[model samples]
Target: MAANKAFRFFDLPPELRGAVFSQLLVSDESIILHDTTFFTLPSAGNWNFLNVFLVNMQMYQEASAIFYSMNRFTLNAHSHRLPVHLTSRGGFLSEEGKDARRRVRNLTLYLTRVGGEFERVIGPALSDMVLNGNLRELVMRLGPPSSLGASRPPERDMEQRPPFQALLRLLADPYLEKVKLLAWKAHLAIFCPFHLRINSSRTDTESVDNQGIAILRNSTGWVELDWRAMVDVYAPGQKIVRIGDRTY
Candidate 1:
């Protein structure tokens, strides 16, 4: 009888080993970065696979990079729920935290409002990420307008809106390659490339309307989205600045 040969995980080719690691570690949903812990939403099923990084030093370096670089992290911008402290030096990141921060490419900021206070807390953090970290794409999720009950003009100019102005400033950062804006009420999705020129006098409503029409005409999955209502809300006078391609 032949003796059973010892099997080794490292014996596999690098590509195959990487594929296996990706299957085990990659997540389809955005990873929630709450406080100091990193986890996928409960809907993605409970997973404690981070411990796999502790198997050995070689695995630690390779897997940790994949974990941080591949996942999209959602950071809450609300003052009460802000996850990390921003400092002039490096904030409160540990060695591993620093590595992860530097490796992370995509980030989403969930904001209660796009007011000055929100900018104060979030602006610096974003600047830090762009300047210090390797952030490639950014998504801003703005909550519904607080003045939904108040009587306001049917259409306000985009330049006059505080939130819109804040958004323009946020997108001015050259480091970000892609930017997406989502408003709760409008269900509006604005996709912008890095070089998009924002014209204060121009409203993006028409462009977005056309884009939405095109999406509905061509896209089979997003037929349920109310593109007309979204376009109408901004029709009065609200202008959407010229951005990148229409994502949907």
Candidate 2:
């Protein structure tokens, strides 16, 4: 049985094709799956983006699962449209696109410096993913903190983007503020991923260790996280945002 002279890409064995996808697409550092960065390709220093999956349907079918399942994704505190990007209809509203969202395994969320008056539906948007996305890892990155004026306008990449309709109902609900236990927390509380890490940083080297949002960062710093114990990493696996890179 001789090989066909007209060997196309499909002729390659499934494993070989997957190797190609991983080689071309996977990132050693976590990928940023945040607002604006999702549709448009942001400059991420040679890391692969979803555009590579646009080759065609068959290629998408073969390569996407590998991409989602193998690599870690970072969702910032401001990524309100997470459901659209992850478990909802997606930016394209395609079945395959939604399926891709459901396949993500390792995820990181930046939850430390939420300085605004309102919190984005970051947790609720990801409810479906945590429940049924076949996710295997969940990493949450918390403080060093930020001051009131720290956040900027949305166009400046500082303000949070809008939330998708997938979780619209939960957006304005006061249950979170009133009850003190977040709606999304219910989903997260039940999640048991294969791997979970929580990394935090701080600076307590000065007399004024913490002042409202203005927490000091110095050579002396330590962290203690007890609000919620769950899996982690971030730009939301953030900047791998080092959780160590910032001050708490």
Best-fitting candidate, measured by TM-score? 1
TM-score, every prediction: 0.57, 0.49
lDDT of each: 0.54, 0.43
- Once fitted onto the true fold, the runs of candidate 1 whose alpha carbons sit more than 4 angstroms away are 1-6, 41-46, 78-99, 144-167, 186-248
> Per-residue error at 166 for model 2, in Å?
18
Q: By lDDT, who's the top model here?
A: 1
lDDT of 2 by residue, 69-188 (tens): 777777655332324543344431234354555677777665433333123345444454555565545655443233123433223222223332222222222222211112121111
**What TM-score would candidate 2 get against the native?**
0.49
Tens digit per residue, CA lDDT, model 1, 3-86? 697668898998888888877777778877653344554344666786788799999888777777777887765443444543
RMSD of 2: 12.9
| C-alpha lDDT (0 to 100) for residue 56 of candidate 1 | 98
Q: How far is candidate 1 from the true structure (C-alpha RMSD, Å)?
A: 10.3
